[model samples]
Target chain A: MPKSVTLKDVAAKVGVTSAAASMALSGHERISEKTRAAVKQAAEDLGYVPSSAGRALRSQRADAVALVVPNSSAHVFGHLYFMHVLTGMSTAANAHDAQVIVSTNADTSNGGVAYERVMRSRTADGAIVTSAAIDDHHVEGLVASGLPVVLIGNYPHLADAVSVGIDDVAATEQLVEHLVTEHGRRRLLHVSGTLDHQTGIDRRDGFLRAAEMHGLTDVAVIEGDLAEESGAAAVEQVLRERTGDERFPFDGIVFANDDMAVGGLAVLRRAGVSVPGDVAVVGFDDFGFARVTTPGITTIRVPAEEMGRIATERLFDLVDQRPGGRAHTELGVEVVLRGSCGCDPERAAAPGPTHSH
Target chain B: MPKSVTLKDVAAKVGVTSAAASMALSGHERISEKTRAAVKQAAEDLGYVPSSAGRALRSQRADAVALVVPNSSAHVFGHLYFMHVLTGMSTAANAHDAQVIVSTNADTSNGGVAYERVMRSRTADGAIVTSAAIDDHHVEGLVASGLPVVLIGNYPHLADAVSVGIDDVAATEQLVEHLVTEHGRRRLLHVSGTLDHQTGIDRRDGFLRAAEMHGLTDVAVIEGDLAEESGAAAVEQVLRERTGDERFPFDGIVFANDDMAVGGLAVLRRAGVSVPGDVAVVGFDDFGFARVTTPGITTIRVPAEEMGRIATERLFDLVDQRPGGRAHTELGVEVVLRGSCGCDPERAAAPGPTHSH
Candidate 1:
């Protein structure tokens, strides 16, 4: 391979001091435009490469931030859905002339503590934390350390920390209301994540609020772990327990996320249960595959990428020590109407006997 | 937040020189076991966080490697499947006491030129290149630079760089053979990726080879960009051109990846085609959602995470100037039979179909 061209080469070619060339390349106002142009031309000619680390060392900022998630490394690549949020953050960061460092806890053993190591050691100027839990000690620690940190999800007590997230409760309420009033569905099953998580808690509260508003007090709730298997297992349990009900146990189902909803859809399809005809379903987090599924999935669309970008930008603002900045941000969510809910006008208007709430 | 404990604090607590304390914490052979234990105890008591970057600088190594993909940051995180591979690399790297830097040239105006910038600047000690094409200039340049580089997929005419990839051709051949011989599939339709990409070329080649071996020459091939939209578009084109044939144009369809296959499945289902009964379909890269979908997709399971780990280790080995190492590695792939391609009797007879291939 050819030897890399150094700043020295550019300086020599331009017949200027290395300091002058550096200043010119950095676009220092003190440098003359003619000398800056000369040095730049020389740099281009010689293919002089600038070192981000070196520049960071001199400037005391790397112009890069780390996006830290807590999980085993293997899980990072295998989970394709995260790619969307990551893409959004990267695009926004790049637009700001910054780079991203993706890191996770060393192992599952340490959990939140591993993040402490990254922050204490100043691995990156700031960090964006995703999939954050309500009692995330790592985030609390980072906030206490005066580090610039942004979270993709909200934690109730971390009022001092910058965060960007969807209003899960409001979004869930919207979906439930649509299913109950608009679709005229009475019996409903809510497949949800562990209630301890903020997302799960908020979504469940929203569903309950909607049920109360619509006077549908007898809603069945099944706990799931936000995984496909969990959804399938929950469905199986529901099916077994609802043996001799005169009215179908549930005419509508709402899943905490798209993955679980999809799983539930699969189980229902395999059992020869009619979707939207016998039952209607809605999911949260409008994932890419939601639309591709048969009958599609009516769901709440969380602006995943936008949330990531905003979170990162908020962290950068903190890193830059912006004054009088607030810590919490809540992004918007939308209800997407699709085939799975059987709400298509044609399907709803069909002449066949229709079940009403 | 409380101030982070530093090396000085550890040394003060241990009643030893900072160098001695550092050596003890590093587990250097020069330090006595008793001294190491005492130093470690002191560090633990004080909550001293060792600096990975500083330690790497002292050791004349970065203790970090870069996983470089020639895509934008948004693209990197948009796909959920990549999370697993990234997770695998991170987990393995952490096991070896290393960190990973995920770099992309997605925004670079000049194609493949970012590799030159990264290498010339020595931003990473070594790098793992994923989804490499046959004529990838980045691989060629890295090889020429004598850098510790590993390719996750095959690259043409580059003999000196280490590679870790599945045999795309063989895996595709096995998938096709299973469809033709066991499932009685005929008139195959192949949905392939862009022909320029190595994986796309090899998979297409394997499909054709299998067809030749089975004495089934009546085959149709459609090109796609290995995305859900591409898959949907390809299926749409095929359906439009079929001219109402009584026999379905193809009894079996093979897709480049799960994303495309899922898209194609959606289109077919919407058109009232019974999966596996009227048409059988197979996808590559058995992603997480493949099983959760109705009629769970049949696919070729590539060891994405394992390959990532192997590539990272090999890159590190090369960076460390290890002796007597080969320049390439071929990882294995397996065929996963699921409901989409018709149930596997053997699998059905066994415990469950949930096993990873």
Candidate 2:
């Protein structure tokens, strides 16, 4: 198909100039009817497909997929969650016979030159965007440009955007229910991450709603950044409140994320507080460390890797022009029950002589 | 400089064919003496650098650095250590205004078409290879092709290779000393990764050497495939031997990597073995999880990120034609004392109710 037919081939068969034959075959009005008919017949006889279209389908493709993390490289690289996400993408991409190129979006600070060039580079078939950052403009811009994009976050405003994510609110609600029902905790404290991010808002709201529904009389919420230090500090604040007021009762604490949970556990340990026996603790984000931290942290597994795989598959569907390519996918999160929520005392980790690495 | 002086400028001034002017300026004898002299004088007067040479440094460049992980993509994306390495590369690449392209050498299975194309693709100026796989031919091929290359592991066979890595043997020796002198652990067992890889070989040799030097009578080495399951099975074997003979006494165990160590810890826990009380365990590779594990896994930090950064810097040196690009660099490792080594009995982890995630 590539070398068998050319303009010259048709022109030679038609006994006309290559330029004239090209124009005639393309139905240019300037060419004589006889000449145009002859050129068209010659083209059909030679089984010619347009070079531009053929190249667009084959030679022009970069055969690479872009994984866009719309956050700082530090954020993406530091968290194993994102690494797991990348792992899934790599696996799916490998199956599709394509290499995935990571776009950390640090270059967005440089007028988004890198992503803009990615749009232009025909080698990159499409992009899977992890819109972890607040700014949606970068993602919106890509969608606006009609580039095939599958986002790994919930963006309600971008109604047409294809997305894959878990229902953070529901997941948090289930976690709170576990505390109230399974652990039989009446007094509860929900320590939330920064409310600026969507995840923080969803989980916080979920916690409050769950507390109200359960008809728990002793419950409170505290605002803190998602840093582990914040978790430790929040725990101290709780202890101080309980000591001073004598009415501030709390038996179970829920950390916004596992990092914070780890910190809170450290503080609880130093203070000689018996976990589950005195104050039950639970965390979110089932990171690898969450499971191994003494009494394993019963947290919400965000399906981060699965999100990556599904998003990539959806993006490829769009790239491949398949049906339902732009469908919104809502993945479910699992409540990984562990010792933190006082599930099973028998599985509690044996004491070791060290607290942290 | 880009727009001010071009080949056209020299061509217009010299009043000769571009081919003739280009050849003359390059000292090609095909051009007549008068033409050559005129072209040379015009080039000098115009401060013109040959387009070919100038573009070789700028326009023809991909302006991206390739990170070649000569291992399966699963091996890389599955491990946070590799992610941290990528983070370091990303940070350094960002500083240099170059984006990093991760090449998970799985394509090498398909005849290395991807990396071979990377060599031909002018946009990728240089490559930093993590020679984790046993095949040195892939690395040697890149070196032989004259592409600027820096390795992140010791490659003694590639004499001219620039590399950055921690001394595994020395690190292991120090780790062994900690268990022997600091913790007073006499009978020991070393769980080594598969010997097919260099890391496994180095670490095993290090463990044997350290044992011989320390003069510990009860020392044994067990080989595994570097999987957590292998470590678990190894622990079970230790328990079985002890149960049957009543003489296979072991006070401490060293795992080749943290994943195995975590596994072994779990096995010990289920067997009702007391960590640091009955058996002190240690691991290599200070993965983030190493610190947070129940009794906290004592580990040797591999300096994965630092190695990435140094290797990248050295790669840029070769690409930029700077001095001393191909020098061997040995980075140091750190021994993190934790509960597993019984370093701080006062800091034993508070027991929890759950086990592995």
Candidate 3:
């Protein structure tokens, strides 16, 4: 096997100091273009790979970021919700010329171990955290360590931390209002994720606020794990228990996330319950499958990918020590009216041709 | 801001040689336990964060692997199937205490540029490649460069290259056989990815072989991009052009991948056609949302996560020059029988519980 080349080889080949070669290859502005080209060419010819650490030693930048999903490894892989979040984070991180280091634990209690390792080892210059709960200890730990951190979801207690997220309350309120006033959806059921999560809490709170404002008192709430099975089981429980006609039980169902919504949709369809014509439904996070399902879901487009991009850019700015930066950033959400919500009457009459994107 | 601590600082504080401190901290067998404890305590006191690249240099290991999806960056983010593959790969990579650097281009043609950059710079010690076509130039380049490379899918031309993938032919045959024997379906339609890809070619060949074996002559084929919309539109074209009494009209559809299958399912449902009863369907890749849809798709489950794990480990072995290793590895596939194929007659009879994995 051929021996690996080193920076000294590139420098000797280019007739320059090793430090000069390193600086030139790293795109330092102090180096002339001719010298940079010569060094790069020599390095390429010799297959002299510059180590990220060597570059960091000179530039004081790791050029890599960490994306922390505060969930167990099992949960991360099993849940579709995390997949969407990961897609957004990875795409954005790659766009910024940075790689993402995912941190997860084997056990739920060891969630902080991954972060501690990243921190004490300085494995990443900055971190983008998703699904941050209020008063999150991990967020606090990251802040205390002085690492640049950005949150993808809201954490009310971390008022001084940079965060990027959608307005969960307003988004859910708009969804509920549309179903109640526009679609005449009485007897509403709000299928929520674990209330421990800020997103679930805020969304459920918004739904209740909208319900109270509209004088719709017959609201039933069910808690789920923000997974498809949870949504299906929650709805099943509601169906098996509901008793009187006067209760006007659940003419509409709203899920906190798309995975749950898809699950709920399947359960409703399986129960021979007509969607929209009977119980209209809406879901959060306009995930890819939302359009592919039958009677396509009415969902709030959370701009998850966009939020990820902006959050990463902000974290980069922090890592670079930019001044006058604010602590939080919020992206907008739009309600995508689809067949399930009954807001699109024409959809029921003449459904659009199903196509893949 | 606090200045980052270095190994030299730890050594100085601990009154040890830099080499002794390094060996001690790294847990080298040559170092005494007492010395190792002293070195470790100094490191913690001084906050000496070990650089991954520096460690890689001393150990002659990159401690990182690359999962090269040869498609463009735009294509990766725009498609959900890639997201699933990435999730699986990420989970596996993380479990092995390694980081995965995902690299893609803006166009498939530009795949070589990104790969060449990584290779010439040695950003990763080894790479697991997916999205390589049968005659992909990128694979050829990597082979010539003598890097540790693993192909996620089979490439018959590169018989020496290590690969971890399912038997596309056998999996496709099983899907066709299930539809024929179980559902009593006669007319079979195969929706495939680009013919240039081995997966598409193998799956198409398998479907044809099954049809021939079953004495069915009416086999129709549609070429799609393996996207949801493409699958839907492809089927829509077939449905629109078919004559009312055309002999052996397609009643069963086999898609090359799950995204396309989901799209085909939506298109069929939108056309007022009942799935399984009117047209049984099967998709490949058995991704997360496949089970959540009504009449959940019957598909082949590719062991994507396991494939990724084996691919990474094999690449590590190759880079590290482990002996007695072969060039290619092929994994297995399982047929996930679900509602879409009409295998579960009970599912069609009533709304069943949502499926979870």
TM-score of 3: 0.90
Judging by TM-score, tell me the better candidate of 2 and 3: 3
Error of 3 at A21 (Å): 4.2
Candidate 3 Cα errors over 4 Å, as ranges: A14-49, A72-74, A78-96, A106-112, A244-248, A346-357, B12-18, B27-35, B45-47, B72-74, B78-95, B106-112, B244-248, B351-357
**B310, model 3: CA deviation in Å?**
1.8
Superior by TM-score: candidate 1 or candidate 3: 3
lDDT (tens digit, per residue) of candidate 2 on A101-123: 76665665534545544544443
Model 3, residue B138: distance off in Å is 1.5
lDDT of 3 by residue, B75-181 (tens): 54435445555566666666666666665543233323666556545666778788787777868778767777878888888887777777899889999998889
Q: What is the DockQ of each candidate?
A: 0.28, 0.16, 0.33
RMSD of 2: 10.6
The clash count for each model shown is 30, 7, 7
Q: Choose 1 or 2, whichever is better by DockQ.
A: 1
lDDT, candidate 2, at A334: 84
> Which sections of candidate 1 miss by over 4 Å?
A1-18, A29-47, A71-77, A107-112, A245-248, A345-357, B1-60, B72-77, B107-112, B244-247, B344-357
TM-scores for all predictions: 0.88, 0.79, 0.90
The positional error of residue A231 in candidate 1, measured at the CA in angstroms, is 1.1
lDDT of 2 at B197: 67
